[model samples]
Target: MICPFCGAAMEKGCIKGQHEMAWLPDDKRDALFTDAHLQEGAVLLASSSIFKGSVVDAWCCRVCEKLVVEY
Candidate 1:
């Protein structure tokens, strides 16, 4: 996939590490782990670590420097 904002090509790969502040209240972390999003599974990849589970898929956008979590 390409970044819509910068037109940069997205790299395909799996990152692994622990993500601190993933549960920040203002971040609305719980929304990312909803049943609808995690119906399949969860694979989280943050700037520091990757967390694989049944209800969350979190990751940091390297190009945009944003937190992206898809459950």
Candidate 2:
């Protein structure tokens, strides 16, 4: 996708790490990802839930040095 802010090309990528959705605040969790894009079969609903690693699709705008995520 193209960056709306700078008209730069966006590269596809993923963010993989120890992301505990349950540990994150409800508002933050909700805001971090779009409900439509979240994969099926939820494994995280609270702070105690854990995953091997969290991978979220994202786009990088090197020109702006910023990341845009679908979440």
Candidate 3:
């Protein structure tokens, strides 16, 4: 995929490290539903599930150093 931010070519790759997302409350989780935005002050619901890390297929733009993940 071509990076919309920089118009640079993207290469398919996998992230090298473990990536995690917090389990947030409904209101906080809704905030992230819009687009690729940052999550702040989010809490993880550890009592519910133990596994929180994930891996995904992604394309990276080396120029901007941004990653686009494909679920």
Candidate 1, residues 1-71, lDDT tens digits: the string is 66555666655444343342233333344565453323334332233434542234444457886544443
- In order, candidate lDDTs are 0.43, 0.60, 0.60
Which portions of model 3 miss their true places by more than 4 Å? 16-54
Q: Supply the global lDDT for candidate 3.
A: 0.60
| Colliding pairs, model 3 | none
lDDT of 2 by residue, 12-70 (tens): 99666554342334444454454422534444432222655566667999998888766
- State the local distance difference test value for candidate 1: 0.43
User: Which one wins on TM-score?
Assistant: 2
Model 3 agreement with the true structure over 1-71: per-residue lDDT tens digits: 89988999999986432345344556667674532124565543222224634444679999999987664
Off by more than 4 A, model 1: 18-23, 27-69
TM-score-best of 2 and 3: 2
